[model samples]
Target: MRGYQEDTPPSSISGDEIAGMDDEEAVFLGYLDEMDELVDDNMEEVTDQEEEDTDMEPPEDLSILVFNKHVGSVFCCDLHPSGKLAVTGGEDDKAFVWSVQTGQIVFECTGHKDSVIFVGFSFDGAYLATADMSGLIKVWKCNLDENQQEPWPIAFEYEAEDLTFGLWHFGARVLICGAVSGDIYVFKIPSGDIKVLQGHNTRVECAKMFKDGVRLVAGYDDGAVKVWDLKTNAVLQQIQANVHDMRVTAIDTHPENNIMASISSDGKVILATSSNGKVVGQLQAENDLETVAFAQDPQLGFFALGTLNGDVGIWDTARQMVRHQCTKSDDESVVGVTKMIWEKDHLITGCLDGAIRVYQGRSGEKVLQLTGHRSEVLDLCFNENENVILTTSDDGTARIYKYEINKDKD
Candidate 1:
């Protein structure tokens, strides 16, 4: 077996000081002991605007502030493709579906035996999937009757030990995941049929669906990326090209082309063709890279890469040069970037410091900075069609924000 083990820090806890502890101890001490101060710090500081409105009311700065739901830190969040609903999963072992406008809990998912590590929405928004650290996945019908009761009935269930990441096909018919045992599992919707594709020797860090959903691009903790064919459950290509020196952190597929972009913990980005696993371009960075994203609009012709030292770079894909870069100011402390997304002419990023910052896509200038979480920001999603953003953090909260256009400025 490849020697690499899956050691990325859990979203429920943060800090390199406690990185050596087992999962159980880390979750307990990090959330219980470390967060005792956080609960007080987060609860006591109310803005003057909030005080004027009411002690318990949400301040005017946010569209919705969800509270009193998760007892532990939130680990992940996703928006429905329809953009009207959102789901969040966390250390509380519960997942919640809520309205974007009202913040009312539409349904509560309560069957997990451990922390819900990831929550995802189907591409068509017809189904919602939640997976826990215990390697259990539960799927729920998203279009259930509005009056449906809590503890939503599961439409499908699958068990695989140490499931790390999951995503749906473009048609929302098949669910795929990577496991710590280096196995890939694909379960078809409504049907219980299961297929296993085995190739990677170490823990799988990330996976992406490409080639009209007939192929999967998987990255492993051993710094290997392989493409698998869904039809025959066979390995289509093994990349013999430039490989990451460290664990592969993230992967993003091109919206129009057959290229896939990936980043490693060693601060390098590689653009490779999906068909043959041939390296097309590589961008080297001065800091360790953590996450990456490709611009959906073909005309943009650029990709975004985020680093451990609070740096964001927009590299021109054609020219293979850094077109723009954004870094923390002198007054701001450096924090690792955890996730990134590209929207209309803007870049949205989540950081280890529990802050979300928006920068201009072309100029790399700071457009907006938001802070509310008491710990690291774990995951985030943006729906351009609805102009809404959802962020989940270790502070045990998921927030919804809308991008407002200033009509007066135009």
Candidate 2:
């Protein structure tokens, strides 16, 4: 309505003029521009909040370097616990293990026949798992020593036919993968024993370990969320029959509590108990959601949600309301937030705008913005101790950035 030409009416023009003056079709053409304006107006408010929001120490930029070994878009990446190593998998059907400091390729995994969609390191940093779009998963034993260029040999492999997601267990002894057919495969390391979790009616979109690795939480395309007992290899409870009006897009469990947060394509985030599958709280956004994550510190266990329309929200799960909307001060065009994580009092977001932004947790004041990727970032991993992050992008590169944090502050 704001951009419509209200002075010209349909009756004021001749037939030929009417065809050329049809403003209704022209109104639809400006939809994206309207969104850009609205988001820009929203984020403009954050500049005001910056006046009073000093809870977070300002972030410092240490480095921004790119890895260009992959010939195709990098789909996934993971940082080891030690913060010294990183792994990335990409569309080129190859996975690369690299040093986070120098961005040097440590080892190249080149056996997958299709695009590698997921790559993760075990909690102990002793193993790495790489999975392709075709459901072939390979586990490698990271043999890094003083050389740092040591070969990582393939220890085992599994095929699930339609792999969607995968991760290493907390102990680094279990490998779990979700399939397009709505089944989950749990592989015991070294032993090669497997357990299959079946309950979801369609594809499994996301899955996470909970209860100190005793249980697993999974979300599906049909909007169902389930918690499984890993020891028994059975679903323990159904967290939600319809967590969202549409497919579940992402999920994140609490750092210390038994609750987990789930988001769907319909723009809703639900916080529920993992043990009994009870709904505790919910938050809604104007745009469909892309990802959600909980902060690691239990005392400040706020959660963050990223939307498809490029908005970011920091919610107080205990209060059941958003504390800050990062885009409320939009000074530029918005882009979808594809990945996000919360560390202490800060939130790190990987945006489809091909930029990585760090915001103060409580006020949503952007502290730092890192730009290097030529396309949307597909994955992100942060190492709090080292103040480093590894990000993979659709532009066929994995990048490493070092953030300088104020250690003197509490």
Task: Please report the candidate that would top lDDT against the real structure.
Answer: 2
Residue-by-residue lDDT tens digits, candidate 1, 1-410: 13225896556545775777789886787577677786556556544546875655332344356544888888888998878888999888898888887788898887898889888887877778899988999998776466766466688998789878887787757888888988988988868589998854688989887747688888888778888889899988766644777788888888764788877877778788887889888778755778888887778887888886777888787787888877743246767788888886678899887777787777777777776665678889988678777998877788876664221111
User: Per-residue lDDT for 221-278 in model 2, tens only?
Assistant: 8888888888898888886565566888888899875789988877777889877889
The numbered model that scores best in TM-score is 2
Residue 105's C-alpha lDDT in candidate 2? 80
lDDT of 1 at 178: 81
Model 1 / residue 231 / CA error / Å: 1.9
Tell me how far the alpha carbon of residue 95 in candidate 1 is from the true structure, in angstroms, after superposition. Answer: 1.2
Q: Which stretches of candidate 2 lie over 4 Å from their true place?
A: 1-63, 146-150, 407-410
List ranges where model 1 is wrong by over 4 Å. Answer: 1-63, 328-334, 404-410
Candidate 2 least-lDDT 10 residues: 54-63
**lDDT of every predicted structure (CA atoms):** 0.78, 0.81
Q: Over all chains combined, what TM-score does candidate 2 have? A: 0.81
